[model samples]
Target: MGNHTEVTEFILVSFNGQPQMQIVFLLLFLLMYTITLVGNAGMILITSCDSQLNTPMYYFLKNLSFLDICYSSVITPKAMVSFATGDMAISYNGCATQMFFFSLFGTTEAFFLAVMAYDRFIAVCSPLLYHTIMSKKRCMCLVCISYFFGCVNCCTQTGFTFSLAFCGPTHVNHFFCDVPAVMKASCSDTFVNEMVLLVVCGLIIVTTAIIVLVSYIYIVTTILHIPSGKGRHKAFSTCTSHLMAVSLFFGTVFFMYAQPGAMSSPNQGKVVSIFYTVVIPMLNPIIYSLRNKEVKEALIRQLKRKGFETIMDNCSTASEFILVGFRDLPELQVTFFITFLVLYITTVMGNGGMIAVISADSQLHTPMYYFLKNLSFLDLCYSSAIAPKALVNFFEEKNIISYEGCVAQLMLFTIFVTTEGFLLAVMAYDRFMAICYPLLYPTKMSKKSCNRLVATSYACGCINGVIQTSVSFHLRFCNLSKINHFFCDVPAVMNAATTYTYLNEAVMFSLCNVIIAITTVVIFTSYTYILSTILKIQSAEGRRKAFSTCASHITAVTIFYGTVFFIYAQPAAMSSPAQSKIVSVFYTLVIPMLNPLIYSLRNKDVKAALKRTLGKKRLFSMNR
Candidate 1:
C-alpha cells in the first residue's frame, strides 16, 4: 500500500507572493463572494416571494441559484479565510469533504442548467404541453434526480481520489482540493483515477452541452417560424438571458476542465476557475433580473407592498450607536476635528443661506428653485445627521452612542439622502422641460406639480428610510457593538452584526442599486433630451443662456454622484474603515458645503437675488 501517513494534510498555494497583492486578492475574492451570496440568495427570495414568477423556468432558476450558493460557499469562504490568515493547510478529511461538496454542487449546477434549457425548449416549441410536462411535481422530481446523480458522482469521485496514496509532496497547487490536484500528489499510479475523472467529467459535461445545444436548436427553429416580427422578437428575448448565462457558465467550465490538464497552466486554470465560481454566480441574477421585465415589475411591486412598509413601521430598537469617527488616526484627532468643524460650519451657513434666500425672494419662486430649496434643506439635514456626532466623537475617548440614537441617525440619514437623490432627478426633469419644450414649461411644471414632486420625494425618502433602517437594525448584533465608520450606515452596522447577514446585504444591495439606477436613468434620460434640444437652438445667446442655467446643476450633480459612487458603488470589502471614513467626510460634509457655493457662484440669478436683497436692506436702514 502507498504511504498514506506521510500526507495527512495538504498545503494550498499562496494566493500571491507579495503582501499587498495578497490583500488585493483577499478583497477581490471577498467582494465576489459577497456578490455571489447576495445575488444567488436574492434570486431564491425573489422567486419564492413573487408568485407571478411561479413557473417551471423560475423554479429551475431558484434551484440553480441555491446550487450556485452552495457551490460558491464550498470553496470561496475557505479561500477567503486562507487569504486573510495566510494559512493554506487543509487536513485530509477537510480536503476530502471540500472535494465531495464541490463536486456535488458543481455537477448539480450543470445538470440544472441543462434542465432549464430543456424547459425553455418545451415552452418555446410546445407551449401547450409545457404546463403538463413541467408540472410542479415533475419539476421537483427533476431537481431531486439532479441531486441524486450529483451525490452519486461526487461520492464516487471523492472516494476514488482519497483512496489513492499521497506519499511525498502533499502540496496542492490549486486553491481548492479537486480530483486532478489531489491525483497529482499521489505516489502510486493515478492512471485509473485520471481515467475515471476524465470519463465522468467528460460524460457529464458533454451530455449537458448536447442537451443545451439541441434544445436551443429547436427553440430557435420555433422562434423563427413565428409569423410576426414582434412575436419572434418576444420569443427570442426569453431565451437570450438563459443563453448568455449558459455561455458564461459552460464556456469557462469547459475551458477549465474539459481539456487535458497538461494543456493549461495552473494560472490559467485559476483565472478560469474564478470566472465560473465567483463571477458567473454574481452575474446570473443580474442578467436574469435585468433582461426579464417581469422581474423588474415584480421588484417594483414588492417595494410598494404594504407588508414591506409595515415591517419598517414596527421596528423599535435601542437608543444609540457610538459614532466611531476616525479612531484609526488617534494622533490626528484634533486636526480632523478642526477640519470637520470648519466644514460643518460652512455647510450649515451655505445650506441655511440658500434656504433663506429661496424663501425670501419671490423672484426665485419657480419649479427649479423649489427643487433647489428642497435639495438645500436636504443637505442641511444630511450634514447635521453625521457631522455633529462625528465632531463629538473626535474628542471623546470612548465614542458611545445610545441604541435609539443610532437608529434615529440611520433613519434620518437614509431619508435625507434618498430624498436628495429624488430631488436631483426632479431638478433634471425640470431642466429638461424648460430646455426641451419651453412653450410647455409653464403648463407642465405648475406650482401644484412642483408641490406634488417635493411631497413625493419626501414620501419616498421616508418609506425607503423606514425599510432600510428597519431591516438593518432587525439583524442580531451580538458580535461587535462598535461602529467602524463615522455614522450609522447600513454596511458598517451590517458588518457589526453576528448573525448571517447575506439576506440583509442582499436587500441593501438591491435597494441601493435599484434606487440609484432608477434615479440615474431618469436624470440621464432627461439630460439627453435637454442636450439635444440645446444643440438645436438657433441663436448663440439663447444657447449660451440655456447652458448657463444648467451649468450649476450639472456641476452639483457631478460632484454628488462622483463621491457617492466612489464610496457606495465599490465593494465594501475593498474599502478600509479609514478610507470609508475619509470618503464619507467628503460626501457628507464637504459636498454639502460646496453645493450652495457651486450654484450661487455659477448662476447670475442667485447672485443678483442676493445683491438685490442686500440693496433693499441698505435702503430700509437708511430710511429708518
Candidate 2:
C-alpha cells in the first residue's frame, strides 16, 4: 500500500459491476447530465435573453449556470460512457485530465459561492454602493478571475498527477480520476502529491470559509437593528437559501477533501464526491435561483412573453419588454415621493431611535453596548446612503444616478459596512466572554478594552474601505454608466473601469487575504473558546441559556463566513457571475431577515422589549 502497484491504466468500478445496474446507472447519469445541461442552459438563456436579467447579480448567475454545465459535463459523460459500454478503463492521461478539470471546476464553484456571498454583503449591508461595488466590469473581472484560478489549480494538480509514474495496476477504485484514486494508481512515491493536496485543499476550504463567516458577522449585526418584523422577514428570506447552499456544498466538499484518505474509507469518499459533483449541482439551481423572487418573476415573464408572441404571430423584441422600466407611469411620481418619505422616516426613526435607546439606557453601558451603538451608527449611515437615492428613483422615474454620486456612495457605504462586520464580530467575542466566562467578562471586555475593540473594528473597516475604494475608484470608468443594479458593487465598478486592473486586483486580493485571515482567526478562536466554556458550565440551565444566545449568533456567523470565504479566497479566474449572484442573496436579503428573528426568538429580553414598544405605539396611535 506504500507505493501503489504499477497502475498502467485504471479500471473504474462503474456504479455497479452488474449488467442491469450498469444500464440503470447509464440511464440515471444520462438523465442527470441532461437535466444539468437543461437547467444550467435554461438559467443562462433566461438570464441573457431577458432584459430584466441584465443586472450585475443576474450577470453573475449566468456565469454560474454556464459553469454548472461545464462542471457536470466533466464527469457525467464519462460516467455515462462507462455505464453504457462497460468499459471502465480510462487511459493514464485521460484519468489525470479528468481529475484536474474536476478539481478545478469544483474548487472554482466554491469560490464562486463565496463571491456571491460578498455580493450579498454589499447589496444588503451597503445598498447605496451595490451598483458601484458590483459593476459590470467588476463582475466580468471576477468571472475571469474565477476561471483563471480554477485553471491554475487544475494545472498544479494535473501537472503533479501526470508527473508521477503510474506503472502499477490500472484499476481505479472509484468512477472517475479523483485525486485520491489517481494517487492510488501511482507506482512512485505519491506521498508528496498527497501532502500537497492535503495542504492546498485544506487551505482552500478554510480560507473561503473564513471570508464567508466574516462577511456574515457584519450581515447579521446590521440586520438586528431593523425595527420592523416584516423587514426582518424579507432579509431572512433572501439569506436562508444561501445558508442552505453553503451548508450543503461546503459540508460535503470539506468532508470529501479535508479528510485524508487514510482516515476516511473509499466508500465514504465516493459518497461525499457525489454530493459536490452531482447532487449539489442539481440542487444549486433550485436552491439559489428558484428561491429568488426576482429570478422567478423574470423566468415567468420571459415565458409569458414568448408564449404571447407565438399566439399573436407578432414577435416583440426582448428589448421592447421592460421588466423594471419606470416609463409611462405618471402615478409613479406620487408613489415615488411617498416611498421616499417613508424610507426617510424609517431611517431616522429606526436608526436614530436605536441609537437613543442604547445611549440613554445606563444599564447598557458596557463593551457590548458600545458595539451596538456603533452598529446603530452603521445602520444610519448605510440606510442614509441608499434610501435617498432610492426615493429619488421612485419619483424621478428615470433612475439615473451620476458617476460621482455612485462612487461617493460606494466608498462611504463600504466604509460603514466593512466597519459593521468587524464591529459585530468584536461584539460576538464580547458576548461569548460574558456568557461563557461570566466571572472574567467585565475584566476582559472593560471600558478601555471595549474602546480598543471598537477602534480596532473601525481601523480594520476603514483600512479595508480606503484600500478598496481607492483602488476601485482609481480605475477610469468607461462610458458604460448604465449600472444594472441600484448600487455600486466592487466587481461592477472594476468591470466598468477603463484602465488596466491587474495591479488593483493584486492589491485587492492581497488585502482580502490579510483582512479575511485576521478576522477568521479572531472569530474561530473566539468561537472555540466560547464552545469550550459552554461545555464546562456545571449547570444544564446555564448551558442552555449560554447556547441559546450563541446559537443565533453562530447561525448568522456560519452563513456570513461560509459565503465570503468561498468567493474572494479563490483565484480570480474561477469567479463566475451566476455563482456570485446566488451567494449574494444570502448576505444581502437573507442575513438581514435572519438576524432579527434569531435575536428575538433566542433572547426573551429583546422580545419583551419589542412587545412593550409595539404595545405603547398602538396605544398612542389609538388615542390620536
What's the TM-score of each model vs. the native? 0.54, 0.48
Q: lDDT value for candidate 1?
A: 0.80
lDDT of 1 by residue, 1-624 (tens): 557866778988745533323433554566556667766787888788888999999999899889888888888899878876789899988999999999999888888889999999999999999999999999999899889879988999998988888865578777888677777777778888878887888898999999999999999999989999999999899899989988998888777667776324776777677778777887788778755778755654565463432223333443445556677678988899899999999999998999888888899998888889889999999999988988888878789887778888989998998888878878887898898888988887888778867776786687568767877776655422678888898778876654455556667766667567656766897789888988899999989999888888888888887777765565663247777767778889988999899989877888888988889899999999
Model 1: per-residue Cα lDDT at residue 373: 86
Runs off by more than 4 Å, candidate 2: 1-8, 16-20, 261-264, 307-624
Q: Please report the candidate that would top lDDT against the real structure.
A: 1
Error of 2 at 165 (Å): 1.4
TM-score of 1: 0.54
The lDDT values for all models are: 0.80, 0.66
Residues 24-116, candidate 2, lDDT per residue (tens digit)?
244345534554665577678878888987987678777777777777788888887786567788876677778877888888877877777
